[model samples]
Target: MGAVTGDQTVDQTVVVAVDGGGSKTDAVAVRLDGSVVSRARAGGSSPQIEGLTRSVEVVDALVREVAGVAPLAGVDLFLSGLDFPAEEEAYRQAIADLPWAPGALLDNDLFAVLRAGTSAEAAVAVICGTGINAVGLGHGGTRVRFPAVGAISGDWGGGGGLGSEALWHAARHVDGRGPATALTEGICRVLDVPSVPELIADLHFGRRSQGDLRLLAPEVFRASDAGDAVAGALVDRQADEVAALVTACVRRLDLAGEPFPVVLGGSVLQAGHRRLEDRIAARVHDVAPHAELHHLRVPPVVGAVLRALERAGADGGALARAEAELVGTAHAALVGGVAR
Candidate 1:
């Protein structure tokens, strides 16, 4: 599509923005005037799990499908597994090689949450989805982030971590090695196994993928809500981890006393678990009284679109319009049965 300016017909700047996460990837083709032309969704495109080439292929396919015949003005990719500078640069080079776009802006997916949650100059975002990670933007463009490569990076507490912990406690309870808890029964029931032993056998014999364990994360919350002590402890620990991440970022950027936004996104955090939210709020407030906690309400792909527009030198009016349009489009998509 093209726009008419004065007596000239100029091709409208189109940006293909993508938010690729560990469980799903979302992409949108949008114009400089904040209009969404197309939207697409695909399965997880995490390079850590799908390999770099495969991950790139998945996102590229979605981008191509959304962009159609429009020449992209910019491509903004905020993806999971681009945790380090090296990884980000590698992806940047790969994206730059694509024929559709001139070049690309790449960063860890957590920044998508940061941008989507707030427009503040200084902010921190903690994502607790299938995995956990955080990023902080401080004064004078200072930034902070974690490797977030799982246990090797000392990362703990995500859907995967919580699920693994549930299984561990269940197995111990079954084998008389841990205290009795409802997770044993809850997990067995959720997985449709007759008992913990059978569940163990199924997981061990390849009847079920270990990754399915992440599905049990919600069971942890359910059990916690039902007054299961073990489950409650796990939930509490998850909150502590989230709080710790925010605290560390606040301290590192020396924003502890300054007003800043702490954006919380990802399935685990957005699940509306009362205890977890309460604990996180209480702990974060104790450390940084001026910090504001913002639970993201829109799909983070909106941030990708915003970043794309910003890169294109869009004015304030364009940004405001884009945010409004993106938010409305996201809501409509969600209501129409598209999963975020």
Candidate 2:
């Protein structure tokens, strides 16, 4: 239930949605009846990750793909990407000039998460993925951010950060600068290599992709559970780092001593490490005893769509009705639609 684009045209059958991320861009175009009309993907498009030109290219490709299928001269778009004042302004200008109908609405991605929650007072969210950032919506749209500040500034909790840490330990151990940790031998074992040298050669020679390094996070977690001191310490440091960030967000917004919503996102926090979440919670409790943290166990895109609906003045009963219809629609689509 998005805001009705100026004069609903017969040419406005396409509804454009995006999950613009650091690694890739995912878009879906659906009909008014919630049927999957088409889908498309493009390279990374986050302004913080990719420059304006590249981000525009990705958005252009997505728009074309949606329009190609629906043949609609106009569309309704809901997007959640890297959000800053300049990025928001740039994206709004680009999309508004698309001549694609109904224009677009630009807001911070974390705002979407805040909109998804049922609470009215305050809700905090921390996304530990390619980078780390925290947001707290204290009523209205009041919010604060942790400002990831890149890896050099000690933001080591995301998938990228953990991967970097694993490699750092492996490289140090291999070079005899640090004691031989299980990661050094375990990684060599997985790659079917005789030694760390061969693994280094494969990595440096471009035989392994970026994902190859990210996949080792789970292995590190497993090895830590198996009593590897170095592996355990790596994960411990990660949880501690994220806990500090979340606590800072809560305290900065004066969300103390309440049953406030402390939401967690990112694969590193949700899927990559479950025990890490428990540790983070423990640390947070130690800092803010009255804070209640909630883990979102569902796809964030659903939350994003709901946020769009909320932004359109659909609230309370209106929101509940829309959620009922959309959830039912999504279920039917998943059941009878093409294998997605």
Candidate 2 TM-score versus the reference: 0.77
Query: Model 2 Cα displacement at 158 (Å)?
Result: 1.1
For model 2, the stretches where C-alpha displacement exceeds 4 angstroms are: 1-15, 28-43, 64-83, 93-96, 101-103, 114-119, 152-154, 189-194, 198-212, 272-274, 315-340
- Taken over the whole model, the C-alpha lDDT of each candidate is 0.85, 0.62
Spell out the clash pairs found in candidate 1.
Answer: none
Q: After superposition, how far is residue 277 of candidate 2 from its true place, in Å?
A: 2.0
Model 2 lowest lDDT segment of ten: 331-340
The CA-based lDDT of model 2 is what?
Answer: 0.62
Worst 10-residue lDDT window, candidate 1: 331-340
Instruction: Determine the backbone clash count of candidate 1.
Output: 0
